[model samples]
Target: MVVTMLRLRKAVTNLTQPQFIEGYRKAQLIDVREPKDFEAGHILGARNIPYSQFRQRFKEIRPDKPVYLYDQNGGKSARAALFLRKKGYGQLFHLQGGFRLWTGKVKSK
Candidate 1:
């Protein structure tokens, strides 16, 4: 049997809040922000992988679908994306501007 390798591309270079919100259900959103920041606010259904624990929990993430990583400022998410790539997670993507630019409702504390 032959195996196929799946590759994921950054469809949107600068993803906006509305765009992300619209694709929320269709994508696997991962929030790489710190606990406090994530607790303060985040897009709906986004999983908190916190950069600190991301490497350790990488296996928990599903590689079959597109992964959307985001942080408070986008930088951390970028780093997380790189980490995922290094770990052979080709189907990885990150929110262009992180949660700061997301216009969706945030979870209450």
Candidate 2:
């Protein structure tokens, strides 16, 4: 388990707000927060897949595309990245400080 976790961690790339935003436009931006959090405010163009539902709904994200993930404070997204990595995802990224530190364009429901 430890070895697998180490490998997964090596696969995930943590990105700063600007780096995340620059790649977000071209990648599959997945907001791993819950529905209420997503509806309150989320990065523009991000899709809500709530971390709670990820095990059942992860397929909604295309494995072939670059995957960018973020949560309210980065913890959930880190776990999400590990989950995706174990499922054979190659290109994985997450916001360093999560959405709270994001200073980019956002939209709300």
The candidate that achieves the highest lDDT relative to the unseen native structure: 2
TM-score of every model versus the real structure = 0.78, 0.92
Q: Where does candidate 1 have its weakest 10-residue lDDT segment?
A: 1-10
lDDT of 2: 0.92
- Residues 38-105 of candidate 2 have per-residue lDDT tens digits of 99999999999999999999999999999999999998898999999889898999899899988889
Best by TM-score: 2
Q: Which stretches of candidate 2 lie over 4 Å from their true place?
A: 1-8
Candidate 1 backbone collisions, by pair: none
